[model samples]
Target: MKNLFFSVVVMGLAACSSTPPAPDWQLEAKGSMDRAVAAYLEGNSRVEAAELARARAQLSRTGRADLLGTAELLNCATRVASLVFEPCAAFEALRPDATPAQLAYANYLRGQAQPQDIALLPAPQRALALSAGSGAADPLPRLVAAGVLLQTGQASPAVITQAIDTASAQGWRRPLLAWLGVQARRAELGGDAAEAARLRRRIAITQGSAADAPKVLP
Candidate 1:
C-alpha cells in the first residue's frame, strides 16, 4: 500500500509539472508591439518585421481583435515600411472611426501620402494631429506628429522643440531620435553646420545604444 501510494503521488507531481501555464495574450501583444517599435527605431528592418509578425500572432490568439489596437499596430508597420516602401494603401485602409488620439495618428499617416489632404483637413482635426502624442499616455503619436509637422513645414522650430522635449521627458528614445534627425536636416538646409553636426552625433549615440539593447520579443 505504501509503495502504491508513493507511485501515485509521484505520477501526480509529474502531471502537474508537465502541464503548461495559460498564456497572457495581452502581455504578449504589448511586448510584441514594444519590440517592433524598438526594432524599427534601431533601423533593424529584419527584427521589426519579425516582431510585427509576433504581434499579429498574439492578437490573433486573443479571439476578438481590438480595432484601435490593430490600427496602432498597422500604423507602426506603415511608418517603418515607409522608410523603404510606399505605405499609402495601408494608411488609407485604417478605420475612420478611431478615437481622437488614433484619428490624429491616422491623419499623420495620411499626410505622408497626401500633404494636400492634410492641409484641407478640418481645423480641429489638424489641431489634434499636430498635438497627437503630446500630453497623451502613448508617445508614438507625438513622434509621428512632430515628423509630419517638420516634413510639411507646418510647425515652427519652437513647436518642434517642444515636441522633442516632451518625447524626451517621456523616455521615448525612438521618437526623440527621429525628431533630432529632422532638426539636423533643417539645420543642414539652413547652413547651420555646427548644429547639424551636433544633432548627427546625438543620433549616432542614440542609435548605437538602441542597437545594443537586447531584442524584447518572445
Candidate 2:
C-alpha cells in the first residue's frame, strides 16, 4: 500500500526537480515489486508471477543485479511469512553482485543471521532480532520477526499470536491460513486433537472448503 504511493510521489517530485528525473524503469520496478508482494500474500499466484516477471524486466533495465536481489529478498520474505521455508535461490544466484548489506539481510531472513548481520536488518526486524515483541508491533515487522523466530524454532507464543492476528486484521488470506496451519500443527504435537481439529476447521473455512485443513503437520 505505502510503496505504491511512495513511487508515485517520487515521480511527481522528480518531474519538478532541476536535476535528472528518475528513470521510468526505476519507478516501474518499484510498482511491480509492490504489486508482486501484494498479489502473493493475497494468494493471487498468477498475478504474483506476472508482476515478478515485470519487476525483473524493469529492474534489469538498470543493469544492477544488486537491485534485482533486493526484489528477490522482498519476495522471499513474504513466503517466509506464509510459513514457506524455501531457500531464496534467485537471490542466492545473485550473490556475486550483492552488496554486503544485501547478503546480511538475506541471511537474516533465513534465520541464520549472525550478530553482525543484525545491524543491517530492516528497522522493524532489528528491534525484534534478539527477542520477541508484544505481538502488537506494526504489521510487516511483526510478521517478519515471527517468521524468523519460527524458522529458528524459537517462535514464542506471543509471536505466533501476533502473526495470526496481523494477517487476520489485514484480511490477508494466504498468510492467515498459513499461520493457522502452524497453530494446528502445534495443537497436534501437543496431543490436543480436539484443538487441532478445530484449527483445521477454521483453516478450511477460510480456504472455502468444508474438509479439514490440508496436511499442515510438519
Candidate 3:
C-alpha cells in the first residue's frame, strides 16, 4: 500500500511539473503598449516598432476577444506609420458596440486610406462624426476635419486657418507643419507673397521648437 501511494504521488508531481504556466496576458499587453507609446513620444522608431510587435504577440497568445480592439488600433497605427493607404482589415472589422469616438477615428483612418473614394460621406457628415470632443480632446478631430475640408474644397480658408491655430496651440508638431505648408502654398497661389512668407517663418519656428523639445521615454 505504501509503495502504491508513493508511485501515485510521484506521478502527480511529474504531471504538475510538466504543465506549462499560463502567461499574465493583460499585464503583458498593457506593458507593451505603454512601452510603445513611450518610444513613439521619444521618436525612437525602432523601439516603437519592437514594442508594437511585442504587444501584438502578447495579444495574439491570449485568444481573448476583448483585446481585439486594442490590437486593431495598434495595427492601424502601424499601417499609418508605414504610409500604407489600404484600409486596415482590423479597423473595418470593428464591432458595432464600439464608442462614437472610436468609430469616428476609424472612419478618419479609412478616409485616409481611400482618398479617391469621394462619396464615402459628405464633408459636413465627416466633420460631425469627428466633433465629439470638449476641452483638450478637440484638437485632433478639428485638425482631421480641416484636412478633409481642405481636400474636398468645401470650407473657406479661414476655417482651415482656425483649425491650424487650434492644433498649433495644442502643440501638435507634425500636423501643424503640414497644414502650414498647405496654407503657404495657398497664399502663394492667391498672390499674397507677404502671407506666404509669414507662414514659412511660422513653419521654421515650429520646426526649431520641435527640435529643441526633449523626448520622453517611459
Instruction: Assess each prediction's global lDDT (C-alpha) against the native.
Output: 0.50, 0.74, 0.51
Residues 88-170 of candidate 3 have per-residue lDDT tens digits of 57646655544443454455555542433223433433434344212232343455455545545554777657766865775
Using lDDT as the measure, what is the rank order of every candidate, best first? 2, 3, 1
lDDT of candidate 3 vs native?
0.51
lDDT of 3 at 54: 83
After superposing candidate 1 on the true structure, give the runs of residues whose Cα lies further than 4 Å from its correct spot: 1-23, 42-46, 61-74, 77-105, 112-127, 130-138, 166-174, 209-218
Candidate 2 lDDT over 46-108, as tens digits, reads 888999999999878767776777788878888888888889999989989887777877897
Please say which candidate is ahead in lDDT: 2 or 3. Answer: 2
- Candidate 2 versus truth, CA RMSD in Å, comes to 4.5
Model 2 segments more than 4 A misplaced: 4-21, 133-137, 209-218
Candidate maximizing lDDT: 2
Instruction: Evaluate model 1: give its lDDT.
Output: 0.50
Per residue, candidate 1 scores C-alpha lDDT tens digits across 1-218 of 11211121121111222346535654555566567766665456777788777766765664442332443534353353222124445324544533443443344454553444444433433544545424442344444555555556676787578766765675555556666766788888999999988888877666575544322211
Task: State the TM-score for model 3.
Answer: 0.52
How much does candidate 1 score in TM-score? 0.55
